[model samples]
Target: MIPQNIVKQNILDAIAVIHKEGVPKERESTKYHLWYNGGLYPPKYVISVANRFANGHALSRDRFNGGAETNNFLKRLGFEVIEETLATKNEMQMSEEQTFRVGEYYSRNDIYQKLNVPKAKQKGHWNTGYTQYEKDSFIFANVGTAGRTGHDHPNRFDGNDLIWYGRNKSTLTQSSIQSLINPEGRTYIFAREDSNDPKFLFLGNGRAKDYFDESPVKIIWSFDNETENHPEILAEEVNELEIYTEGSVKKVSVNVYERNPIARKKCIEHYGLGCQVCGFNFVNIYGIIGENFIHVHHLKPLHEISEKYEIDPVEDLRPICPNCHAMLHKRKPAYSIEELKRIIKDKVTDTPH
Candidate 1:
């Protein structure tokens, strides 16, 4: 929201902020401009960005309009408002299609209304709809809360893995649970470390390691550092659709991922259904239910590939157990299979039998 009067210095500061953070892709203008020192800036967007200096934070686009109201306000401040060509708009670099950035914080309303991500209807383990940038969905969790039924499930970390419990009476076969194993899509975490925090931290992406039975489905989620960064361009405010307070929470979720399935199938065909690092065969342990169960790991991770790459099943893929797969990706760049195997070997050799 724009104030009655804003000094000229705030407009200069907003221009500087735009250069540093780049403009939000959707908010960039194609025709209108507010001329300043020979540079053309988007009319309403300038005020939206200028809010940091004028109102202490940026406001969402819906809170104000550009046409006559915003342009006239800036004119009253003695600034030149001019019509510009679409070609002039290309001068600024646009923040690419990215989502809730890792390490940054966001409230529920930012996800639903602002970003247009579908609301996660479930209280704890939620099913949020698809995100626009990628075909995969964006899911979130408000951690550190026990259920209303008096069950204590804080979703604690065991070693590097986190054991997350689904909503009350949830089963291993629920769509949310199935998302972990679904090869077509992967899950990104928007989790608040402390339930009372107003916003959630984008805590990397997660895949399924293992899961157990119902009432509240128990899943061992293995997280990877693979995450996208939403440009730090917007104003930070306490806009919320669902709030997580002490002893109670309103929560949401969505399932999504991106991968090469044909390559994965070929890798399984070559490697067989067993863990390459530890030789843990799913069928050998769990019989029929575990049949064909294994996580196909890319020797070359997706984030590392900048251009289109033809995946080689023999050269770039491997069959790994969920536990070992999690360990492989624990660090940046991920550990090589030989390196992880040696780690297991060294630990076993050091153990007293």
Candidate 2:
């Protein structure tokens, strides 16, 4: 058996690896296996925090009978061992929610009403349609005609979507004419596929100056348009292109970073650095090295966010330890703090010595 201290370090290292590289695949276990002095350490290891049993080693089976002592040790360190894998359920829910949130899975006929296309203008094969106006800013919807705006017109292709040439002065005035006698220079361009696939794909802010000089206007489609640098242009141009062309219909997944600094700080401030599940305090164990150090977990899985919702950090977040946090996320929806507490109770009851 590995020394208790080394085992503890190994566990901590494994948790860190999970935080950095995500859950390791079954085949990739050796890649993340604990190693010391160039030799394989922790001969019996937990393959995945998300999976309970696949590689033959009992995840909950530990030194103590019924693994109570092991469970207790992990709990004290702020971790829990899960019993099943339910990440798929959570992922399926998230997939549906993401599709709905980004306006991707709407029906073909509803595309016109969903995009707020004018009733009188909905009958024709007009390549461009006007959507809603926000604060007097016009939002234009262009149905990509396989890179064709007019008969034999020059087109700029960017993956599956077409970048119709920019508008100059008189042309700009003509494009802005809605016959409602309301023309706004500030415009937003949203793109939809051809009439065959009428689902809107992109939304972008357009400025007259960018188009006045014939600067290439890439169609706006990705919802992840905001970035630290440029807020208007494609935040991740290449990645967005891939998503727009081929990736969106595939298994698109959101990478949820559980470590929310704002939420973490708020949780720690409200509850202190003590683990809410097992009352473990890192500073009490390791002195200055662990001061003000505690892992904050969202009571609700971060991957389930579908819209802009306010999270009350104190109520929605809690400070736990690495072990407990891992255990919480072991299952798809994650275990509640109260549920983990009950697991500790049951383990204590099972272990007499």
Candidate 3:
């Protein structure tokens, strides 16, 4: 039997190793196998890392074969267990179970690679969102720093925006833009730090509404708050909530939003296909091809509201394009549609064109 203190120390030490090396892949150097709570399993048809605890000294090839005990332990810990098949050369295959299961906890790039979503047609870029629908509706994002690699200095929430970064130097093509702004997509964010035991803390989910080029090379995908209440998720001070063991797992919860699809639909229906602030309509300009396309923005920011409140489709929601929606959220309290329209008018009049 392992002492509680020894188990705690080993778990912390293992997390430190994973923080540096990431979850171990099959047949890669096994030095980082310390991160797996149970004795590490051999490379098999599917690779998995369970959160089952064991004595650090006994993690060897012989004791590594996982069984009923390990499965039971994982169930009790509430860890979302996943087993993914190796992606073969020339063809990638993944079951639907893998897709829905992944978004519960993985980052964008991580889910793309794990679920074997169809790759980008061009080299040097990858399709981060899926064309296929899942039983569950969600995507995962790592908020903090440029690449989830440091302090919370550049949090998207701080900028009053939900941001997704693109591959550096990759040309932003029309296809890339569609993959990001497709109205069907929704995202679940995770609070990740440079050093954390589990590495991901569940935040909440929302819809991807717009995209912009921060630079010629950098693409920013912006999302709107649909039904997410993210105050607790965003308020967490880095490393303050310890998830060192199963008992401490209450720090994270499986938060799923009760999104008002009816309200979203009605807002677009009433406002037509044009952005309320900028007056940009996908359909009128792009012909029949862009019909029925507009993002619905919630007037009140979810973080500010703590209790359940009824949504008024006309008063609480507005149909806006991605650009207008992103601008509306640029300030802390967020600019009203009238204010944003006024700002746009000023910019347009000031320009020589």
| Candidate number achieving the greatest TM-score relative to the actual structure | 1
TM-score of each: 0.36, 0.29, 0.28
Worst 10 residues of 2 by lDDT: 226-235
Give per-residue CA lDDT, model 1, range 1-353, as digits (tens). Answer: 56755567888888777766767778776656665532456778888778778778876778887788887888787666655434233322221233544444566665555456444442232333112223354545544454334545656545335567766666767665565556455466565444455566555466677877756777776654322322111112122212334444533211011123334445666777678999897544542224345766778766766654545667888888878977988887889999999999999999999
lDDT of 3 at 293: 48
Writing each residue's lDDT as its tens digit, candidate 2 over 27-76 gives: 23321123221122222343223222222233432432323443444545
CA deviation > 4 Å runs, candidate 2? 1-257, 302-304
Task: Compute the lDDT of residue 295 as modeled in candidate 2.
Answer: 64
**Steric overlap count per candidate:** 11, 6, 0
The Cα error of candidate 1 at residue 351, in Å, is 43
| Full-model lDDT for every candidate | 0.58, 0.44, 0.42
RMSD of 3: 22.3
Output the better candidate (1/3) by lDDT. Answer: 1
